[model samples]
Target: MSEVSGPVRVAPREAWLLVATFLVAVAGLIYELIAATVSSYLLGDSVRQFSFVLGVFLSSMGAGAWVSRYVEEALPGFVWAQIGLGLIGGFLAPVLFFSYAWLGAVALPLFAMLVAVGVLSGMEIPLIARALKEIGAPEFRFENVLTADYIGALAASIAFPIVVIPFLGLMSASLAFGCLNLLVAGLSLWLFRARMRAVHWLAWALALLVSLAALWQSERLVSVVDASLFEDDVILSEATPYQQITITRFRDRVRLFLDHSIQFDTQDEYRYHESLVHPVLSLAPRAEKVLILGGGDGMALREVLKHDRVRAVTLVDLDPRVTELFATNPELVPLNRGAFADPRATVVNRDAWRFAEESTDSFDVILIDLPDPKNITLSKLYSREFYGVLTERLSADGLMVTQAGSPLFARQAFWSVARTMAATRNPIRPGAGLWTLPYHVYVPSFGDWGFVIAAPQQHRPRAPGLPRSLRYLTPDTWAAAQVFGSDIGPVEAEVNSIRDHALVGYYNEGWDTWFR
Candidate 1:
């Protein structure tokens, strides 16, 4: 009879059950990824985000696993839980984004969501593994369960950055993954309707419908929140490959914020950059080829361009968008006086470490206008290895000036840079004079900021020899600013010379006090 048809072998429904299980897993992981990224971009403190998120996620997952072991209706419980997870994670991303935009608060609600999703995610694999074993699959097929789990994770990680984030973006990506979870839930419910009680089928259907509705409305919701949070008539806001670049202006106080760290509040930025650049240049009468690392705002270029004799001003900033924004934005262009558009200056958009690594030449005066080394990337530039490359690039008689992180708040951090520099050479004295200045801008948004300057390594800084328009720098006032407190005498870590992360650790501790 029809070649004695082999008993119609429809693959065991549980095999397909495992596939649906993976879709739920994908939704949970995407929620975790989006929350972590939003927090990182908005919060500016990665260590805290990574630590808090990793802990909350793993611990919540353990709780979820514990609960799964007690699931009496393992099959229906597994299916319905998967459906609930789809509903939650599907909309979780947009929800978090709106919350941050509205409340400027995320940690509390963020952890709660993490725990919820982690619980759902935690139950998925174990329940599926049990379901398969019940369906006559060998108990030793644990390898199959593990393989299915990891391969799904691989697909998700690949899709997230490559496809989801770039094309669908955060809000759409989150909801879309949610829908995928719902689809998985629906299919599992449909295939097992005979085994599932009728009430459970209705519950799964309702969850699926709710997930789809949320997916449809997520874009509108996220767009509204993005507008509310990033408001300022948002002249320009872009997420660059390196960092988030946002520029906002209100009446006269034009501001540029990089990764939520205010780079300049134009109202009183002059106090900071002027002190940073003019002091070092005043001492060096003949500074022709100046190499600047990390002055993306073009403010330092404005100061260096004043020399007129600075034949080649090579400014290597990490973000081209920062340079471009300053160069083009009307509000910012006037602030820097279009210094980036200067033909004599060559701006290179590159990481300082990598750029320093591959450099072929030296400069007369190397001015480091880098931010505080609160993060590892900036820490690396302030490290001994980075400074070693820098030392090689300096003219033997050339002077170098680094805007060491504040002397008042970060004495250890500031002195660490000085000590780190001295550790490389013999006979370490105050390389140049030291100058401390408090920058006051009436930061309507943030409070007053302070910056400290260490004069060039070898020579004393003179007053401003150039007679042009000036706001806050003069030769006579230079020496007096270098005086330090008796507390600045010496540090405990002597061998903290080179190749260790002592400087970064000290910086984090100092900043922790500020953040606290």
Candidate 2:
């Protein structure tokens, strides 16, 4: 292998082919990302869905590479692959969304689309390389084609998270990329018109037209699919970079769903938010400062602000889109009673785990109002390590509470959270362990939901006094919430930590058994 590398001259035709390769690579990776994301959103386990999607897609690409050797005409094969990629990849998100909504099952259809896109993507590079060689270009190396592919993939990886998901959303972004693929096909047809047949021309025109049409109507299509999934008329639907936020209304009742999991129902949400906030706040010796994590909707903030002693409240939630919507939207602002606009409330849009680990200020009460540990990312928030960090931020006599999942439905999960919090020793005094008290409240929207209140020492079980305007959580009801029935009582379970995500498994298994 002598070093014969000078400036390797590429003709205009070969350069165009390389551009097509880059565009195909971008479209291919976008489809793969869309599949993994959609699966994770629908399936409930992000780590598993991403692992399966990556493995299947790479292997299918290898299979496609093997099959590409049989094609006699390289240009025709490349053009057809582009057409197929545009048609399938462009509509992949919409099809998956509609299928999950209508069929109530997406595993079969999701994997099918994944394999089709991967195979077509895999075939593209080989066909492009062969076409480059077939055109008698001067010294065009195979590595050049791969360089364009690798760079294109890098571009897509950066854009998908920063621009695509937040601005265009999954449905529109996929359709837009599909149109890009179709344009690449049309460009290929024009570049090699001498070799293209009449059928290739017709196919290129049809695919481009279809992709453009879909791109134009992508929002309407998503609205239709979303209407099928939700029970009521969807008034607000947004896809943030972090999660999907949906709000629906029927008559006087409104519901908020994050990634299709119900967060609160306006009819009975007072019960949930009241139970989550008031118990620990009522028990704290001097609740001057409060820190709230994951209650972006400000419902918990509303409860916290009800107490006049609260000087300031710092609320940490990851998604600004969520907090902003609830803060400003006229329909939603009333639900939280304009908590975000309060003078004492400070909202920080950042990850709870990172904020907990990095926070320097000590709080009199720390409230963990996060979602269930359905995935590893959320599971970490419920882990032993995260609890340790949170414990460090609590004042000497401070109290902390977390909104644990359903005690009746996910018994192990609820107790596991209690156990994890109990295991968290006070950083100031290693000998003084947290006192854990688990309780449950029944709401009309969600039955048998649980909460865990922990502090340095045992606090009074009965509330000193409650807000007079409270719709739920009277002093008597608060006392009864600590008493659990035998059926939903605690069981032995391992502590959840960053290294071992025991909570996610317990959560998934417990919910799956009940739902199944």
Candidate 3:
């Protein structure tokens, strides 16, 4: 027989106690967010981190439930669980980050942290149910505890991105949630004073107070570690539901780092944006209505805006803060020349794949300026399935350009993207695609960054839209970018199709070597 039972009868006053229990449940949310973001920050890709944490947490929740069954002492179990929950959950973020630093890998730590949080988080609901059960009524109180738990979850789901992450960042947010857990614990002690021991009250009170103090200092501790990780001085660090965004400046350069990867370092950004924007725009003879994915810094927008003939430029970047900062910051604004504020632009802060699949619109040109496929989340963007969506949105004479990483560095990754697009024959069956396009790589900052200008028909060179401050690209350079030399070593890169998981492999091989 199961030891767990429903509340036979419980009063309104005890329902408020269950609400306190709900606060500890909110700690569950902190585990999910931190696990996802911390992994994406240290190791890239929100999707992989989220999936792993979710799986691990579910398993840990089961472990916690089994452990919960051993608690014969109801009030003591509930009290210690809250106190223990507060102590462990409160310290999770900083502990995990330091663990990650010491371990030099977050993949395992992320799930491990979630597992710990899940154990504590798992204890909350059952403890609340137990509390309700002890309050003279058992059968009917399960519904009320569930109702309170659900309400806490609803609040946490909304609050995590909108408030928690933004205001508190990761460490402080976890600290605050931990404090909330302690508050629930403290409140339980007060409400159930008749059943408590003196040491439990005194020891927990001191610990709860100490934890609140630690959270107050969480940002300072995190800032030190985060700043040390980058060459530039970190001026700001904030976490959104999507990613961890950091702004850093070194002398003349203003840089944006997303999930610890550089989005733009103004000093060498010309290489990324110019290489990304120009190769495609130069090949499209009558290109207009351009669709740009993931150029949030407005650097690509700066290049796209140069073409006065282009009608509408739809730049879909995931994070709004990046666009807003680039558009407004005095240092960065000149780089893009306030392109985001222009009437010809529509800035949609959304996932590009979802947007492309849902939109009824089509574009004459599409520029895929996304970051390198460093993890599963980004890997999908380089997949055949995603390219299939891009193919759907291309006009009859449309040209699509994708930033295919460094050919000299991650040659396989670059070629795999080109191969994946070629495999998207689904989009070509019904008058969908052209025969052949151009494959080019540039040496603006990093040498030989790949660009594949894809179309249904054969590649025919078009007029160039040279920028005001041109350093590397010329008529000769444009043609030269197309020619891969013998010195440019060959790599047997796997195709980055959705089913095969290609981009992640290339990214790991290429970037790991480059960093070394």
Candidate 4:
């Protein structure tokens, strides 16, 4: 008598249940991904955040399935489960962001919400399957429902990164998905109204109303809470495909942060940039062409342009929005000295490694001003393989300099750069027997920051002679930078590679001492 049998047709109402299953499945995974992404944004270590979030979520789901066995009447329980999931998952992003801003803590409330949603989500599938089986859908009911659930999850996973985060951002995207969950609940109630008794239609209606209201005002609410996360006024905040970029201002100073890590503080950025640019550029005085790997803020480019010999500069940065912001923003223009506006500078917004691999032209000086290798994505740039690629683009007398992070804080990580450069595979190119000159500068913003200058066959760089006007580095100061205290001296570190992320681990372990 059921649809899967000889001559029976599926009931329209029973068919809708499968559709509801798909929607619920989609909402469940979206909530999980949202939690993981938010955690990554706040916490520097993506590996730790995602591992913890997934482990906790799956455990809670198993508990939910175990508890579902006691529910004798599945319909009402299923309806309430959907409602609970909708309410919690819908508001998760806003709640997490606010908690991070106000309490400066997210582990407790984040896990609480994840557990609550996972339990409700876990209960949903079993209850739906049971209801379908009881409706006389035949033996194929289990297979049919499971297939729909998987398809829904696949759709959500693909759409989350491509459409949701890029356009609506985290807060609006979560609320929108929350509405989808509520709609599924409302649809289920309408379809099964005949079997219901004392269904709280009024309460359900009020919940839907509140969800819609919150969705309408999600942006404004998020903006208010987002402002609290930073000390200065947040002039611009955006979640791009690659990372979250925020620019803040306090009086005349502006600061740039990528994924919650400060790139540069405008107040003392000169000390950092001056040291990063001048040492390499001065050593290679005839350097006409410059390649900058990661200074999207244009601060390093500003210093690189100060030299009269620089003819053309190619800056390869992964994020276009960072370059766009620095190029156009009035507050940041003077800070970067309108470097992007110069005809000599060409901005290629793409991955540095990819650019290095594909670029045919060689440069006299290459400045690697990338972020610290705290995560795998950044660690790849600091690998021996990456240094090998850089060797291909260096001219006969060219020099490459990299910002090697804080020598005092991340000593092993600092030395790992020199280790990787020395391990470059192409050891026979002109000046191919690469040697790294390690040095450090005391920048008040980031104490005891280190840098490494790598050149072919050069034991020690011929002092390029400091620029006549520099805020931080002088000839005497540059020489003094080579001396390191016994406490912050180098430790044995492995050469980082695409296959092995030894430096990432070292960076995490080294920085943990300070952050923890």
Q: How many residue pairs clash in each candidate?
A: 4, 0, 14, 1
The runs of at least 3 residues in candidate 3 whose Cα sits more than 4 Å from the true structure, single-residue gaps closed, are 1-13, 101-103, 107-112, 138-147, 358-362, 426-448, 461-468, 486-495, 512-516
Question: What does candidate 3's lDDT look like per residue over 1-516, in tens digits?
Answer: 879966555556475676675676677776576666676677665677677777888788778877887888667787787777677767777777776656565556556657777776676677667766677653545776767777877888888888888777888887777787777777778877888899888979887888988887887888777766777788877776667788888787877888777767777777667767776776676677999999988878888888777889999998888777778878768878889888988899989999999998988889998888887778889887788788889887778888877777777777777777666654546644335443455544456677777775555674465666665566667766767776554455566766778678876787678774
| Residue 59 in model 3: lDDT | 84
Candidates 3 and 4: which is better by lDDT? 4
Number of the candidate with higher lDDT, 2 or 4: 2
| Residue 15 in candidate 1, Cα distance off native in Å | 6.4
Rank by lDDT, descending?
Answer: 2, 4, 3, 1
Model 4: how far residue 478 lies from native, Å: 1.7
lDDT of 2: 0.90
Scored by lDDT, the top model is 2
Would you list the C-alpha lDDT of every candidate in the order shown?
0.69, 0.90, 0.75, 0.86
Give the runs in model 2 whose Cα sits over 4 Å from its true position: 1-9
Cα lDDT of model 4 by residue, 1-516, tens digit: 666747657787678888888999899999999999999888777877888899999899888988888878677678888778778999999999999999999888899999999998889878888887766665445788889989999998998878888898889888888888889878778888875555546657777888899999997887787688888988888888778888888998888888878889988999999989998888884689999999999999988888888999999998888899889988778888899999999999988999999999999999999988888878989988888889889887788989999888888998888888877765456444477888888988888999998877574465666667788888888888888999888788888888988998888888899878
Q: Would you estimate the TM-scores of all the predictions?
A: 0.78, 0.97, 0.87, 0.92
Q: What's the TM for model 2?
A: 0.97
Worst 10 residues of 3 by lDDT: 431-440
Evaluate residue 332 in candidate 2 and report its C-alpha lDDT on the 0 to 100 scale: 92
lDDT of each residue in 113-154, candidate 1, tens digit only: 888888888888878777776666533367777777777777
Clashing pairs in 2: none
